[model samples]
Target chain A: MKTICIMCPVGCSLNVYEKNGEVIVEGNSCPRGEAYGKTEFVNPSRVVTTTKRSGAFSYSLKTDKPVPKTMIFKVMEKIKKTPLKELDVGDVFIKNILKTGANIIVTGKLTI
Target chain B: MSSFYDVIVIGGGPSGMQAAIEAKKEGAKVLILECNDSLGGILNQCIHNGFGLRQFKEELTGPEFAYKQYSEVKKLKIPSVFGAYVTKIEGEKITALVRGKEKEYFSKAIVLATGARERTAGEIKLAGDRGAGIYTAGTAQKMINYYGKLSGKRVVILGSGDIGLIMARRMTLEGAKVLKILEIMPSSSGLRRNIRQCVEDFEIPLEFSHTVTRVVGRERVKGVYYAEVDENLKPKLETEKFLECDCLLLSVGLIPENTLLSEVEKNIKKQIIVNEFRQTSIKNLFISGNSLHIHDLADNASEEGAIAGRSAALFARGALEELGEEYEISFSSAISYTVPQRVSGCGSFKIFFRAKQNFLRKKIVVRCEGEEIASKFCVGITSGEMQEIEVESGKVKGPLTVSIE
Candidate 1:
């Protein structure tokens, strides 16, 4: 279990070893580092991003995909109790936030 | 009512949208302008995801690497303006202030990708007492990656660079509490995979030589003192320490905001010096990317905005040639400043640099008048990585150097 592929910028350096449930990987230079070492050895998930509060400010969001890693602090506490006075850059708001089915959206463009 | 152009970039970001899409793919007509009101810059709040690996080899994000060059400048419609805001330049004319009146335009060759800026916290003079939670790690990464705003719960970053280690894991994934980072230099001007995935996979703590020297709060923050420098960095006074924190980001350095050339000449870190096609030593004023240095990728500032949009499309069709002697490259002392620092015989080029320390295999070499031409061997070089090499055009005629040993 070495780890390093934070997905890109050639972070490389993987090395893992699991056997039985299966996983071998080693110093990967691509194959997306063997699917990021078999999903960081079974279930890493990530694509998070934050900011939800509304009224005076708070906009960014993201999660249309990659979620699990034990649901990043229960999806940042369900996007900090989801308070978004207005959404637009791809809306969605949270069709499945912590259930980890993903779908959070609004990756920019707000007006309130 | 004036607009005529041949090239006229001026900050649309990602090196003025890759120097107006490489000077409109060389046919030249180009425009760009952009003072923000859209058109990607700062890749719309840079949402993580490694960014176009090596110019679109996958791993995208930073607004899908700036919406794939703003959808190729809107499918080749090019001609941009977006809130303009120039306000004066003189030589090849420029004026600006577009949307609220004033205008002027003209162009023949002008790029100046006005980028870099972020030092504030009283430009690292920080003593303290002034109120409101302090910021400038790209304004707390645009107030939390484009307004998601959690801003502070405990924060206290202060610069290990790489946007204070990616905002100490984006303010600890929006929960806040970062606590330590410091770095008065001893290493980590960032990127070792951003100090290993944003501060050693979130264990945080960083430290290094240390710094921050006082910043308590008066209205919003509440504590943050710091110390432990030495080795010429000063501040050791019995190793101070304070830390209660409310928020204080400040990821230290970055300069070159290239205020439209200003009688040219700069490089005591105000950058704007250029040569070898990124031009600006006057001749139609080019200057690209982090205002001409400070480029650690955004695809090397879109390959120096496609070589200053093909040398401003051969200086707007006059065929741009002139360059035979002008050598003098020089370096050594492990190299730290060398972006076309002067090398015109004009043909083959490349020379990017960075590495004033952190070598593990060494050799780099290069030279010319002193003889030994080209050499390389490098390994783990680092100085926050940039390194590039390539030199031809009669293997540098006059003064050249560059060493690593």
Candidate 2:
């Protein structure tokens, strides 16, 4: 698989070849790219955003935690359980909601 | 018929919103005129994180940051006219040519928060067919962030600025293959945090001292050629190569949006030359945000915006005094340009600028009337970080010069 390294401003064109589920990378100009290539092919994580309900108004608790790339769908599911009663904007909803120990702060608010 | 208002804000971005909130705190009736369909000027479309770190003391996305300010503006009963396009601002009057399909209205003190627009591909001529695949990084980001549209499967981003670096990561996350980011300079122009969070973390290749010599494409985009540059920025031979690609995203730079201000004052290279209070050469009318000066972060813009707001209020109240003679800050070792080429007779002020290059340890000195008044040391200072120094406004009585040691 071919990818671009997003480590520095130098978006290096990287070549990743996976054999036996092990990732080998090349064409990267720095060591950071090697680590990114390994994690990208193995486990991908991302910072996710979504909304939580509380009464008629919906409060958004956008997570600042970088969750596993595979768990984005499941994390969204778990986020649905938390209600936004009395929640305000910029309010951190779940402290480590995904058990990633990454604090998720409220990013948006939907009100009438 | 004309309605009297205590304060009127033009834009709804973080700065404009903050200015409106501040002005309203003075117990004055405030109104915000937003040209866009909704509030939040550029912040509405900027879907990435890295905002409100200093002001809110927490990392917030652009929309999230905008939402916090919007909620305040909404709760404070800060009336806003959405889809209200402002046309002119002269003296104490502002003319906004508004139209919502046959309905037209005029409103009058304009904040002039109309933010700057991105310089398009047409301005920077890249050798190749001006095709569909070419786009500014901001445009591509709007497509993906708002409309959920992918620019292309393969891409080559030019200019190692923040937007380009962030888009490199964004495109990769969306399953698009980013070929590389070619920068004309020896070092990247983006922030260190962005370089770490967006580029380095994502394993994106950032080629320094390299530039796109030629772009190869017929209708869409086929590929691009890169080459190294010398000290004078002349393209060096024997270092040219081609990569296959379908898209080219240019994150060149932003020019201040000063179309309406043009009728009042002339432009010096497309930037409105303003006084200490951010008042353009013309009196009463003020410019802030990206319109006054291109800032590194929204934080600086907000700070300047609030000052402009206060100054506008003071002007409206006829409390403004004549500006003193201009004082210039000269760079010697590694200092870049400083704003407010002339300092007014104020008490306390902070100067903002960037370093010429990277340095481990350095001393910055401020000299006025051939006497050094302020001296400070720094650590790990790089061109990536904008340097802001606060000095007692009373320290410098006459013209001053700044030098780095």
Best candidate (score: lDDT): 1
For candidate 2, give the lDDT of residue A13.
Answer: 64
Q: Give the runs in model 2 whose Cα sits over 4 Å from its true position.
A: A1-62, A68-112, B1-3, B100-109, B263-270, B322-333
- How do the residues A1-112 of candidate 2 rate in per-residue lDDT, one tens digit apiece? 6666645433566788888877899977768779877776777555665444565554445567567865665666676555545766667777887687666676654432
- Tell me how far the alpha carbon of residue A66 in candidate 1 is from the true structure, in angstroms, after superposition: 5.0
Error of 1 at B304 (Å): 7.7
Interface root-mean-square deviation for each candidate? 7.7, 7.0
lDDT of 1 by residue, B277-371 (tens): 88876788787888777876688898888888888888888877566567768798778788888877567888888987778887787788888
Error of 2 at B63 (Å): 1.5
Residues A1-54, candidate 1: write the lDDT tens digits.
Answer: 877777765466788888887798888877877887888778867777765657
Model 2: chain B TM-score relative to the native chain B: 0.90
